[model samples]
Target: MTVRNLPPVSELTEQQQRGWSCVWCAAPLSTGTAINLGEQRHEPAFGSPYWWFPRACPDARACAKREVTGDRR
Candidate 1:
């Protein structure tokens, strides 16, 4: 199994960059108001590779934690 991650905004494809709202905080996205969190790809053998594009709001801070396994929120 292998996983591929997307590049920064400058290297993102046009389709990948097409977003009117932020993927993280639901903020208006534009050339000047977007925080590119890059894209990611989850590879699977059963179907097409799942592609994910995450964009953060201007006021949002960057943080990362381990993936939650169950209902811990």
Candidate 2:
């Protein structure tokens, strides 16, 4: 699957709602097994960081990548 970037600078469309769909697997974002990368908050920001676009779910990672190699954080 091709990884696409969700541009944050653009206005939010109805499809952007959290309950809409996942960028990777097209699953509902509300699914218990799904996750969004933006939720991680890697960088400090007062507002929704524009750089944190194309939110991804945990299932987006490949099965081989599920195993942590070095960093747990």
Candidate 3:
């Protein structure tokens, strides 16, 4: 979806809300999902309407890398 015409996060349907996740990383997202609404100058397929969860947090990789990186503060 294009970010310029994307429906507001508040207007998302229940299914959409429940399905919200990082397409790339399969990360669970909440209302806390970061938003950057603006133009659609970039390719829409690259995640125009992106919602990112912190990569530095307790993700799948983090568990494996914890020994080296320790907990992200």
Candidate 4:
């Protein structure tokens, strides 16, 4: 699976961080239909590394379409 570069955690919503929504388009996702982006580790300058599980829509093209069309806020 191609692991695309993820957006910064700080820019993501809590739902995105928890893998409940598409990381790119912020669409709702079900486990069976979502593509797991894998575990992400964020190392801060002053603290321990934080781990996050990210997922995206199965159809990346659609997600990108939504993003480009401004369907997602």
Candidate 5:
């Protein structure tokens, strides 16, 4: 599925990168309840490339709402 471009990895929290929270809203998400956005690869300037998993709530609208309003849940 298509999704908006993710925020820069440097700006994301550990939970967001680990798929434990919504990437956009920063809301906690139960396993199997979030939509996997797929693994992302990052090539740092001084280290080997690494991958980070990103997930989001099933309801994109709600996620966006929470993001815009700063309502993390």
Candidate 6:
């Protein structure tokens, strides 16, 4: 079997810009806010990428979970 690598967020199709929210806690993530994802904690990275979690928040776990679980509460 072969493993196919996925592209980075920079390469993915851009989605509509929306307010940042935590995947696990469903809390809104903003600048200087702390977001916990499993074993890691994330802080916001402000730059051209706009709103994004730090490297510690790999794979956008919170975002993915929301997609898969369809929790629009």
Best by TM-score: 5
> For model 2, how does the per-residue alpha-carbon lDDT over 1-73 read when each residue is reduced to its tens digit?
3455553423443344342454434344554655554532223346554333334445546421432332212
Model 4, span 16-54: residue lDDT tens: 999999898998998899999889998877878889889
Which digits, one per residue and each the tens of the lDDT, describe model 5 over residues 19-56?
99998899999897899999999998888999999999
lDDT of 6 by residue, 1-73 (tens): 1222322434323221122444332444553544332222223365443443321212355555765686643
For model 2, give the 10-residue run with minimal summed lDDT.
63-72
Residue 56's lDDT in candidate 4: 95
* Candidates' C-alpha lDDT: 0.46, 0.41, 0.35, 0.88, 0.91, 0.36
lDDT for model 1: 0.46
Which ten residues in a row are the worst by lDDT in model 6? 11-20
lDDT for residue 1 in candidate 1, whole number 0-100: 14
> If both were scored by TM-score, which would come out higher, candidate 1 or candidate 2?
1
TM-score, structure 5 vs. true? 0.92
Q: Which segments of candidate 3 are over 4 A away from where they belong?
A: 1-19, 35-73
Question: Please, what are the lDDT tens digits per residue for candidate 3 over residues 8-63?
Answer: 44444433334443222334444454332322222344555644222212243543
Q: List the residue pairs that clash in candidate 4.
A: none
Cα lDDT, model 2, residue 33 = 56
What does candidate 1's lDDT look like per residue over 1-73, in tens digits?
A: 1222434544444444555455433344566766666555656557777666665445433211111222111
List the candidate 6 regions with Cα displacement exceeding 4 Å. Answer: 1-27, 33-59
Q: What's model 4's lDDT at 14?
A: 92
- Evaluated at residue 52, the lDDT of candidate 2 is 31
Clashes of each: 0, 1, 0, 0, 0, 1
